[model samples]
Target: MTHIDDEPGTVSEPPRGGRGRRTALIAVAVVVVAAVAVVGALGLGGGGDEGPGAPPRAGSLVPVTRATLTERTEVDGQLGYGAEIPLPVKATGTVTWLPEAGTRAKRGDTLLRVDDRPVVLLYGSLPMYRDLGLTARAPGGAGDAPSGGGTGTGDGGTAAGGGTGAGAAGAAEGAAAPGARTADGGTGKAAAANPSASPAPTGAGTTAATALKGMDVLQFETNLAALGYTGFTVDEEFTARTADAVKRWQKSLGVPETGTVGIGDVIYSAGKVRIGRPGVRLGQAVGENALTYTGTARKVVVNASAAGASWAVRGTAVRVRLPDGTSVKGEVASVGRQATAPEGGSGEDGAGEGAATLPVTVTIRDQKSVGRLESGPVTVEYVGREVKDVLTVPVAALVALAEGGHGLETADGGFVAVKTGLFADGRVEVSGSAVRAGLKVRIPE
Candidate 1:
């Protein structure tokens, strides 16, 4: 029986400088040996009870099967609370208390205490940059009133106070400063023109005041209402009713009922947070970088190659291999828009040196599925490509045809030309009129 170990093809060597006659003889001998080897490999030179189209006697046969093919890429990742974000304390005070690292804090919870006063955490996108309070309103329209009123409804459906639209009233009041009432009940046209800056003095001899307003006001109001402070409609305007609720909330916190929210009184985050270490020590002056924080949920961060980040699209389903040899379902939460090279021009083992990488964040489907792992190295598998219910055969079963492309040898010694598709594992996707599941194919040993 003849076995085909090497491929059945001609082997050529580069020309050598020597005697012309000897070189020619050696070349002829090499060609003869190559031809004999090809004949044996093709099962034509062996004496066997096989037909001309039969594969070598020692070749193995495998049946073609249908299966789902997926191309996956695994990359090293870190399991932790995503990324640490710096939380700078904008308020001027000495740090009286700080939460221990890895402690979780949620909305309406005191993250830390400054000067014995608690700095609460709220949910919002905008940061608290100014004080929020209800500005004094003029009794009636006198002179050119700012034309703004509190549209916020009190315990009843009635408007909170001054007759003005909800959106416009809060904005106008926010533009003016506390105590400085405008002729038009705190809604100054000048304030509306520039809400960020304090309202300018008008010819009516009224001093313009600055009160906190805008979406930030609305965000705080939303949080306040969520915390069970009722009797005030949640709106952008901080009306008298809103101030009353604020006082109640302050009383609950054991703080003075100032009826106003001062800057640094509350910090805004998206949702729940896991507290990091405090930059300042106890009784130390709180600088801008007083503390750090991160999302409470567990996540895996992967620094994927920028060139191969196409599979890191947000919402893409993935699998995370844990250190315990277990895997959990996950999905891509975010992909960095910019690619950055590793610092010092060299990357870690996962990322090659000098390669630009895009940060990819993956969130586990079930928070409790991760067990007790807080932070460690992990492996994330991303599916790069997928093909379902396709006929496939061992890659070794493919035979290179002299013309071009590939063919498969059937059990009956018939050759079926096939078109190759996705290659995964040790199998190659095959399609042809004659290729079907359960069809046996020959693979040379």
Candidate 2:
């Protein structure tokens, strides 16, 4: 093994390796044996005539070194799709078909078949909440708008009877009430009689042509447009052109070409999904939860102890030690807020019961870094502490002084009191007035 010597009064070991920790321990044992032999010779008068200020010889000696010290902690983690989310069904029908477990589906792909119609997948954050169709602008007419909301036709054109009907109604109201205004811009006698009354909006006869509008509409139109259909603007309003595009999409899926899309016609997710086992059987009525899915990418998850979870912050860089003795770089993707107790038995900390843990998600930076491994237990390593440009020695070098402090013994049998800083990887930082580079320190046998 290589030795580091920067401080005169200490000996330090290098950082421990993933697989070489056992080997490092064995080497320490060998060094102890050799030191004992050297001390035995010194005790047998190998060094004669000790000076007044010099102490008796100890074990073998090693020089101290100034180097960067880092402490690392390793935790157990499992590699797989981060988490599975249940896919709820909103359509009312019999479940005719379901994809096999582990099947992958992307945008516009069929996720499940209900009543012999496909429930397609789409990439979006909004859920479908209403049927995307036209609404008539006529007052109390056959319209799709709900109560207390904007109403219009999907064709972006004026409503029928908007001219003559509105003029007749205005004329009748102006005659009945002296202050009301007619269809024309001039105010009627009713307005002079009641100056405080607010005039009815002039454009009430002609409503702005619009359709069902919401972020969901925009998401649907975007996905529909992306699937090669055209003529509809991708926006929050689903207009006549959007309904026509939906019909074309429905035709391709062999579904009814009704110019409306029901809430159950599509499912939205973040991106491509890998299907889990179906929760309901074929021919059964669709229930609240029909199946499950997860993102296509693999990730590492750790059930870290809540008490020691400071390192589990999101975006923190980490190293994953694979079973094959190799390592890959990753970062914390998420950290769960809720804590849960272990199911049974001891946990990683050897706590027998009632140990709570929070879930942590780690994302590998490179997709192919883990090689062919799909899902398995792995080790995640995090740096616990670090100190740079400090004089360090093996933890075995320091000795307790009778004066209520710590000191290191030099090769000349002189003792130098020192202050300790950080202890990491079997080495420690030490400093004192007399301690300097190349000062040899004794290891206790």
Candidate 3:
């Protein structure tokens, strides 16, 4: 101590063994303190303020609900009757004897009268000759000819010269001279004897003397019934009784009482009669009027544009939305057998004033309801397949997570990843570990 030099702010090193022991003791004390602190926190039940095993704070959330879903398709259409017909002029002539615009006719009753022109004789002599010549040239033509007769026999017995005799001789001569007559007055007597023979009728009973009877009259009566008239019977023959009934109906309706219902009358009664050209006028030739009358319009038909027709189907349920927003339900009754574009216009082009559309018929199942809005515009809808019992969540409850995904706050103040499913009526279905039945969730404010 007497020889030690005093150095400023300097100290000498201690013994190595003693220094190591002191450091170890300090490390042990620090470890024991940390363990005690951990044990205290766990025993405190993981309370807030850095307690061990405590869950993180989370936003509010909602649990997903399960529901059934149905897929639907929408369309547009109109309400109409199941049957319709277009009355056309039965025979071409000047219009005559039109009772009224909306007259009703019984079956077999005269609907309209055409100017009774003499029966038109369509001379087929040249055509017959040509046909005969062609047949003669055919390989089997000669074989078909009767024996003991030449080409004249097959020429309807019209030959230049031939004998006139009874039985076989007359037959042979007739076969030879189809154009030529035989002597002995046999052909003349035959013609005189057959004076009662007449030409067969043609062209759908549209003749001057064509009286209505049988099926034609039945159709007429059927059409009348469809128009809501029920007084007369369809006997397929026009009778005074039918005409009387028609006249009575016409009078009741305050129309002309001519006792005859024309095509115009039928169409008008059915509610689809147009009033332009070919209308019934006074002094028009009865049965000779050029006015074309279609059949009675029993069913209402609306034509759809090509694009609309493409999506339509037979018997597809349709809803008619009215201009006033009221709606009625029905089904597609029929589609046109053929497609017609607007005359002189392309399909892609907009329809012009004169453009025609493909016809479609929508049948009303509930006539009483449809009758309330007849001839009105409408919109239609169709329903498709259904989906059942799927997990769904409210569209508003999802939160964006940090990993570019969605998450839901768990009841235990934790976060969970969920998978989503079908979306309908503003709700989305979801699935995930965090998603469970009756699980309370925290949603972000």
lDDT of 2 by residue, 151-183 (tens): 112222112223233343443333443333446
Across 189-257, the per-residue lDDT of candidate 1 in tens digits comes to: 333344565533322223333344689889999999999997887877877788889999999999999
- Put down candidate 3 lDDT per residue, 225-298, tens digits, no spaces: 55456666655666666676666666665666776654333312332232223345645643433333332322
Better of 2 and 3 by lDDT: 2
Question: Candidate 1 clashing pairs?
Answer: 145-184, 146-187, 149-169, 176-209, 176-210, 177-209, 177-210
The order of the candidates by lDDT, greatest first, is: 2, 1, 3
**Candidate achieving higher TM-score, 1 or 2:** 2
lDDT of 1 at 377: 98
lDDT of each: 0.71, 0.71, 0.44
TM-score per model over all chains:
0.64, 0.65, 0.38
lDDT of 3 at 337: 74
User: Candidate 2, residue 134: CA error in Å?
Assistant: 2.0
Collision count for each candidate, in order: 7, 13, 50
